[model samples]
Target: MDGEYEIKKAYASILESDFERAIEWFERAVRLDPDNAAYHYKLSVTYARSNKLGKAIEHARTAANLHPDNESYSYHAGTLEAKQLLQDAEKYIDGHTQPHLAVDLLKQALLLDPLLIEAYLLLAVAYGELEEFGPALQAAKDAVKLDPQHVEANRLFEQYREKLKRYLRS
Candidate 1:
């Protein structure tokens, strides 16, 4: 079948919320026209909807590289990369096994998506876990700077600030 026909099938599958079929059809389209940035972008979106973030990021990066002038494609690729990093950070943070690793991941995520308020919040928690109260307070403050009205960020900022003050006194 032609790549265009495969793309159409993928779109129909997506409209029906059959992400598995959409992914299959999009994969076929990508295989048939490997250089087609549009096909890669569509496949990336389908994979993302299916919660296959690794696959989504792979295709998104390909699409962005193939069509560098498409700001949307580049933006999507960066966003997906940031989300993947954030998710990885959350895994470490949730397990409470490696705050240092989590901090590194959160910093990378924030570099890619500076507006990710959650990354800052998580960074604060990771720093606090390491007994780095000053950095924790700064991370919390960064979160608050991003969204001054965020109740949790504001609360965390106050908590970290107090911790830092006590650490300084001691």
Candidate 2:
């Protein structure tokens, strides 16, 4: 309604898995406390959960900017940005898929969370699809370093490693 009650309602709605209602209440809370970084942060997470990447990234970046020391906000925003870029990369046209943007986005994601093993794996895939074997191998290596036991990452590493050797020899 006004302040704390609205926040409580937002949290309750979130716990109940009523994301639409959570968004409504969170928006009201933000309106009531426009400068509250916590409110903005909560709104960002809620938006991400609802698959609204643009809004989620906007609010998460705002919260991170409002409190630069908060690594969580920056990390969350970067993860969302990477996800959006990966989606963009996965899109198709007639008979082709474009994953060029994924390189930059995945780099940005790693900057925010260097330990993001999935980002490395995805970057490897994107680079491989683009026929950039060297970069793809490097990305796969990075993923393996982060998570040596990760099934997909390990597979990518082996695949790219062999590809690189073939490319070098040929």
Candidate 3:
């Protein structure tokens, strides 16, 4: 079959949630046309869904390098990096030293794409974890602004608003 056919097959496999088959077909497509950033991006998403963060990051970075202005690629890279950072933060939650770094990663993710609602919520939580109520309130507000219907963001925003008001009153 043609490269395009193989690429289409890979996409179909991905849509079907057959990540292993999608990876194989996408790899073949990449081998056939390594310059195609779309193939790399799709492969990166497949790898991410398969829990292969390292490979997902590698391919997402490659896609971003190939197409610097592609917001989707950059967003994918930022999201993957944020996931890794969040995992690391969870590992150090009891140590009191890693939440700051986690907040930094979540901030970077939001910087890359301000529309990332989950990142905003996570950043707010991380800020709250670090006792940075002011920043937490800001992050929560941003999340609520981006996704008014997001339950967590709304809840966090209300919670932080009340807390900040009390803190200021005292």
Candidate 4:
């Protein structure tokens, strides 16, 4: 079969939530068309869903480099990078720097894809950790705006709003 046909089959498998099969087909597609950024991006997503973070990051980075303006690829790469950074920050930090680094990563993720509600929520949490209630509130608001039905976003928005109120009172 053609590379595009294999890629389409991989996508269909992914859509059906058959991650293992998706990975197999996507790998085949990639082997057939190694330079195709879209194939790499699809493979990255499949890898991520399969909890293969290292492979996900590798393919995502390739996709991002090959198609810099592809917002989806950039967002995936930023999300993976943010996750890794957050893990490192949690392990090494004793003070405010961990949250600060999280905030920076979330900011980069948001810049890449403003509609990423998870990024906004993480940014809100990071800002709140730093006692930057204003930015925290704003980030929460953005998260809720992006995904009104997101339980975490709504909870975080209310929490940050209360924090902002307290900060203003003090």
**Best by TM-score, which number?**
1
Per-prediction TM-score? 0.88, 0.82, 0.78, 0.68
Clashing residue pairs in candidate 4, if any? none
lDDT of 4 at 95: 55
Pairs of colliding residues, candidate 3: none
In candidate 2, how many Å is residue 64 off?
A: 2.4
Best by lDDT: 1
lDDT, candidates in the order shown:
0.92, 0.82, 0.82, 0.82
Error of 2 at 107 (Å): 2.2
Candidate 2 or 1, higher TM-score:
1
lDDT of 3 by residue, 1-170 (tens): 33687788998997897889999999898888888899899889889989999999999999999999999898889878777765665554446667787787776666656676777787777788887889999999998898789899999998888888888888
Estimate the overall C-alpha local distance difference test score of candidate 4: 0.82
Clashing pairs in 2: none
How close is each model in CA RMSD to the real structure? Answer: 1.9, 2.7, 2.9, 4.0
Q: For candidate 4, what's the RMSD? A: 4.0
What tens-digit string does per-residue lDDT give for candidate 2 at 1-170?
A: 44688899999998898999999999999899887888899999999999898999899988888888888877777777777665554452112455676677677767766877777888898888887899998999998898788899889988998998998899
Pairwise TM-score winner, candidates 1 and 3: 1
